[model samples]
Target: MEDEKNRTGPLMIALQYNDLFDLDSISASTNTEDALPKGRAVAFVKAVQTVNERLVEQNKSESLLFEVILIAKECSEEIKMKIVESVKYYGLEIGKFFFFKKEELINTLQSNKVKLFLSTDRDDVCEALHTGIPAALLYEQSDDHVLSQLKVIFSGDVIGFSEDSLDSLSDFGFSETQIETLKAAKICMKEFAVLIGQMKRRFGQENSPLCICVLTAWGSTNVCVSALKTLREWGLDVDEAFCLAGAPCSPILAVIKPHIIWDGGLHNMRDLSAHS
Candidate 1:
């Protein structure tokens, strides 16, 4: 990629994708990149995620980072010949930080040039980026349930169960502390939504630029869901809320959604809660 492609925004690094489901798009091959038997969705998603980490490390610089994936696996298998070229992304970052280390990660992205990184070794990639070198990683996103949850959260969509209230969502796996923060944020989100509504009435209907809170982890679902509903009811484009959350059960939590996806920052939630 060119130096300009690596440029950055005031608080964001640029991310570019060559293919939505193209594996060859990335230099890393079969072993490193996630491969799919019937769907290129996994590979495409992995490449996009790798690009995200790089963007975080690049931060506001004039550097643009491009992450590509090889997605023609199934087509090749069918015809017994390769048909390269396919990739996609939900590009853009800095909507919200729900995870603690994410700030550290973003801090790393701001100064260094992380060329690419994979989502599979998320913890490991994050560790390597500490050196301030442009890097890359790959990952795949599947599992409809988790993806659904992520999609809803990233889109700022409300996750409402048929039950009026969840007796316990421990199946999602979250620490007690995270749950508490989600609860408080949930209540606050209701008020926040009302303010957002008033903003819409004053400014007219357009959410190109809006401040939002993100919640990560199942522990955060209660408050996060409440907040989302409130925003929708009050009339803020909640899908544009740009909140954050961190629960590492599934690979692609919120990315499948339309909103700008963020890695949730639960441990980091303290700083935000303290301020509130």
Candidate 2:
């Protein structure tokens, strides 16, 4: 009884349905090997329900509450409804089963209710980890291993799991040429980190926050945006935000005054008052 009391509670699992089930060519007439079958979907739902039932039978429901969240992106509402109905048939309560779109995912994952995130998308896993959520990747190899890995995520042993190479630009839906352009224009994370450190050291205590001018091409826009979010996260007050057209030699410039500037791209920390 004491050992049972010390056991970990049930994990709240957020499953990205697109990863677990194939939706590449889901259509009424298109029944290919890659298409997710209705029978398989039902079986998956029932398997999860069985786990919950076993916990309840052992009187461990209070210690652990198994919940499943389904996230569907680029799928029709009809598909979403069908999936939801299938899960409901397996005795999954309305509150325990949730469906969300790509846009709604961040907020849902940030919620304290979700304990672990499971996805096949590398970007999704990264997003979850960035927001301080534990995430695991679902592969088609083995169900037993995947289930065990989910528990590992809940235990906080693994923060993110993805075997795929991460192409941020591509994952964000940029075309092949655009991805190459973005890769060339984008500032590396190390450079961004250094810039953030410089900001914290320089204008971190200024009465008026420093204004940032982000000048970059369209392909590198995400880099600038991520930089802004990172700045805010560091508790720095960003006075103004501007996106300039054309790619400047320097990706990020700090406008200390009308004339004074700090160039992050060059790592130039000198007072530019002489040039002004």
Against the true structure, what is each candidate's TM-score?
0.27, 0.42
Q: Could you tell me how far off, in angstroms, the CA of residue 189 lies in candidate 1 after the best superposition?
A: 14
Q: Candidate 1 lDDT, tens digit per residue, 1-276?
A: 123333342222222221223334435345433332323244334333444453445454523333332211123242222222111122322222111233354444444332332233344333433443222223244323222111213222222221223224233453454444334333433433443343333322342223333333432455566546645665555433333343342444334332222222232333222110
Residues forming the 10-long window of minimal summed lDDT in candidate 1:
80-89
User: Model 1: how large is the Cα RMSD against the reference?
Assistant: 14.1
Residue-level lDDT of model 2, residues 207-240, one tens digit each, is 3122333322222334345546654543333444
Candidate 1 positional error at 65, Å: 15
lDDT of 1 at 140: 42
Candidate models: Cα lDDT each: 0.33, 0.40
Q: After superposition, how far is residue 66 of candidate 2 from its true place, in Å?
A: 1.4
lDDT of 2: 0.40
Give the worst 10-residue stretch by lDDT in candidate 2.
Answer: 152-161
